[model samples]
Target: MKVIVEGLHSRGHQVSVVRSSDSWYIKETSPFYTSITLDIESGFGENFITTFVAQLLETQREGKSAWTRFKLEMEQAQKASELHENTCKMLEMLFENKEVIQSLHKAKYDLVLTDPAIPGGVILGHYLRLPLVFNVRWTSQGEGHLSIAPSPLSYVPMTGTELSDKMSFLQRLLNVIIFGFTEYQISQYVLPNYVCLIEKYLGPDTDYLSLFQAADLWLMRVDFVFEFPRPTMPNVVYMGGFQCKPAKPLPQHLEEFVQSSGEHGVIIMSLGTLIGELPHDLADEIAAAFAKLPQKVIWRYKGDRPATLGNNTLLVDWMPQSDLLGHPKIKLFVAHGGTNGVQEAIYHGVPILGLPLIFDQRDNLFRIEVRGAGKIIDIFTMNEDTFFQGIQEVLNEPSYKKNMQRLSRLHRDQPMKPLDTALFWIEFVMRHKGAAHLRTESYRLPWYSYHSVDVMLLLVGVVLIILGTFAALIRCLCSIVHADGTFRRKG
Candidate 1:
């Protein structure tokens, strides 16, 4: 969103950012945009997330048994519900605040630009009858494409399954089961709170899912280079790696560290912002692995200093990740497969040694691995030897680098910059007062109608009726012939 804001501000657009008062990132003042701070708690506050993530990590470390998996799923659902419930409370406050509502109405913004991962902005956009544009990869339910596009379970893998486009029969079955569970999660855990708000404020006829799928333009955060070939809607625009750019000069300390690595090159690791620390024993094993590596390691961790810390490894609370990835001395990336980090790695043509901890991290790394550009380490099962071997395989093998560089070429060869493409579509929506022409009305259709189940049932019924009539006609003709034969015999 900050990237989009910067782009729009550069193009002489006045932007107003609405954020929670407790937002960790968004500030009250900025040259780029005017900030509107709401006095409400966003359920996804830092404390809530950090605590939740810690719990998840602990549960995962309990082993991959069915009970552990079930616990993890249930915990995730419970947290999702809590998050949505908090968002609903905020929405309720916003709706009740006449002053804020009036001000928003008077602003008359050209469009509502939002990440639909949380649907508050989506709902508000509909309430304002404004053109909606989503800067999206994930929605409140799951992947954005699953909601608006034709996703066949045969190939389009569900979020947590970590399967690719090509799958065996059993994999497809697993995909279907996962898909069912995902739908159940969304309906049971995520939607009810939003439903109440919709019915109370937007009227009973306004469907929550429709409000999301009804977006005039969906600036998708992925492209075919990173995603498998699948059915998509016209309104969905691919802007994968839009946030990625040419790297800037690194900080002097980091540059000096990279230079000191000499012929061995450097490897950097970060598990993104949420998982600041690992289980102490796990961290110690990772540290031990780094200790064995001749290549210098930079690990971004906010955990206790591992007992096995090596002189060759430098642990920091944060680093200029993209800058480091783009550096020529950098040999490999050890990442948790966050979208931003993955795209940047692709942009910089760096092979990954992925340590996927949670959510879509595994899937993201799986895509890279399938492309031969990366390898994944199961944090649960990985030890010092396995971890070191994974790193060595990525560093020692020339194919890893070659494959990643090829991907880099493909990503960079776009007709226009991804960000520019996104901007064009966004402006297109505004200029046209909405890209309704491109959006599908499929969201408005009933589930049966959308799948054409009704049409299929009608066709089947017609065929069955025709066959029945033909069978009856044949029986009647046979009877008549038999009666004639009997009469002739009697005469």
Candidate 2:
């Protein structure tokens, strides 16, 4: 199949890509340059200014040799952390390279797939008028914010909503002075000033919203085991855990260590790439928790350890996460609840204790918690006491493990793997010229699209008012005319 995939390309099926790549050599480390040119964190098409700024904030403490690589990332993060500002700004490159992209789109492809992360995939998918699969790794990519948007304005970045449900009296009064009239106008007026750098540089594309609705199908990178709301749509399938590669072999010593741990098992601690830092005291408490447990701990700390150490605990800067999770001897997983880590935990059937820091971490862990497959430790309020106690509870109880195992079975019981499921749907669309008939009946409902509670109430109010007005007119006429003689109208 002439399939085209647009994503990190680090994993998943092979496909064409138009993303940013800059090589920075280690020896030449500076704000201007570096040794390795790794792909940008968000997606491909992010232009120079935004990429430079984002990289500035996302990096850890700068190395003396690195020469302000750390400083740049931090500075950029401060400037453009808001989603609307960040996304619209990052898409500048799309506007700049419009002609070239248009030419690329005209080229033939059997199938086109993209992530909502970079609306480019959606862009290319639509331009070609080809079969498109929305690879939604994040939950907010859905139509609504799913009940967690910080403010109504917050939805502007993700959903393009125009109003707030809970506009406070003070906020309304302040907005009158600040924004004049119409909340939508106010947000639109201010959005450009804050995040219009992207639009300024990238130019424009009018069809930005169509890419979302015109999807042929969607390949969700979420397992049913973890996502509790359960995709109510038929076309949206759960095959998130499927991947092309097999597990790499574990080191002999590592294998022996896991096997020797017995029923107590090994506890794996890892916070995925973005939020790897463990607060000083939390790390100590975690290490201490390991001391209390019979199970040996294999923690991927990724930073300098505290002065103390326990005999049974092992800490390293890196770990073979997938391989370790696949190990039969591992009993518990401590994760930051990133989508990838969540999928990995479920695939291996290991119970997870998620400590979410920011962004989708809270949403990701919330899903797992709601599904009854895992436990969560709030990063903001979590202390050594709660952390230690949570771990002990997960370890001591059998329910969490049993539930995880049950989910794993259901996940694996599918006749077709997730990757295969995605492949079939993609091909089906290609063969049928976007087999859109498969989209569910309910999604097409007027209620689904309109979301008109207030509108419905208004319609009822109009009918009642019209009826009441007619009744009043009839009564007035009857009072005015007395015994067929003309009379004054009733006041």
Candidate 3:
């Protein structure tokens, strides 16, 4: 059962990645901008491109052509850097690899899994005829047209603008078509005659939907207790709490520090990977918020500390969070609502106060609140009072603590760990020879497979036909005779 996992470079994978830099001919076939980025300069912190995309969102608010601006912004985003280009170009190279390409033509796969960003995974599933599983690690409602909910709709902020409630059907269709072209351009790793190339290669078929029916599973990084991904299909599995292990023992000093805090315990705060720099004002506000509490604050602030420091507040750039959550006396966990961080909180039965930033953090916090496991604080309005209120509410409310434990049990009670569940599903496909039969029900249904729009239309049409027949009969009867049974058939 040869399974290929794209965009994952963990030791757990089967294929040792061939570095693009080492292969001369492969590098020559590679996208020019992509090769430059892979040459070792742009790959380090290329996430600046996403921030750049975030920044361009402001200009998108200028005028009636906001949609135009939004479209241009997407173009600007891909053009902004080569990390994205290299990602697409690499897929293109793999597509060209005669060996890989031929194997795909005559699919020798049991299962194929990929991160959401790997579009080639879409192409591969088509070639290999394997079950596709999307293991989502972030907030990916997918690209513009494919987005369902909680996806940032437009790069531009929709509120306080002339934006319509939803992009009209025509607009959505256009976006789908546009996204298809964009994907092809991305595959080529440069701007070319996208429309002409798409027309020549793809014809007038205007659907951005990939051949995803080949995939049978979608392993969402969500837990039933914390995040509820829309229960749209049984094929999608939420295994967030599955692979987690109990936290290892904390260092002696840290354990002593937390336990020494007594009934006051300690507050844990970490902002995650990207935004390590704690703004001075937020730091001051946080410090002030904790000043009123009896708890000692362990803030994961990754920067030069302010000159003013309280005796109870500890500013450490690095803290092992798993160990922190398992600490004997940690009262509350204040985090940025990343999946791993939130999972740790629920994993250790610790109550939470989430200050989510962009991406799925909002959706993640919404799930947290919905689950009654935690409270969310908007990062923008996070002052001493708001922060204090949120933390205090969570700490005071015994239900939050109780709920955390309840979820911890449910998460742990599953038949196997999530990793095991994931592994089982992948292997299950191999044992069944690609499990293509499982997708038969979906294929049996028409294009309205998920929604049943066809059913709705059929019902409406039936009603209309019945009404029309009744009306015609009444008209003919009235025309023939009003009060008498006998009359000339037609005068």
* Cα RMSD of predicted structure 1: 1.3
lDDT of 1 by residue, 1-491 (tens): 89999999998889999999888877789999999999888877788989998898989999989798889999989998998998999999999999999999999999999999988899889888999999999999899998799899999999888899999999999999989988998889998888779999899998888888889999999999999899998999999999998889999998999999999999999999888899899999999999998989999999899999999999999999998999999999999999999999999999999988877888899999999999998989999999999999999999999999999999999799999999988888888999989988888889899889999999999999999999999999999999999999999
Query: How do the residues 1-491 of candidate 3 rate in per-residue lDDT, one tens digit apiece?
Result: 01223212232434322234433322333212122213322232436544653444333323337575456546554553355444445555564567755745563445566655434454445445556666655312232213222323333112122222246666555545545654554445432312332343345542224344335666666665653322244455566854456678887877877877888889998877655655577677777887788898888887777554577887877898987898778889998877788888888888889886544465556556666888988666568899889999999999988888888887778777776676666666656765555553543345584568988999999999999999999998896676454544444
Q: What is the C-alpha local distance difference test score of each model?
A: 0.92, 0.58, 0.59
Candidate 3 residues lying further than 4 Å off, grouped into runs, are 1-86, 97-110, 117-120, 125-130, 137-140, 143-207, 228-230, 291-293, 440-491
Q: TM-score-based ranking, best first?
A: 1, 3, 2
* TM-score of candidate 3 against the unseen true structure: 0.68
- Taking all chains together, the TM-score of candidate 2 against the true structure is 0.67
RMSD of each: 1.3, 9.5, 8.6
- Best candidate according to TM-score: 1
Let me know the TM-score candidate 1 reaches against the reference structure. Answer: 0.97
Candidate 1 residue-wise lDDT at 356: 87
- TM-score (all chains, Cα) for each model: 0.97, 0.67, 0.68
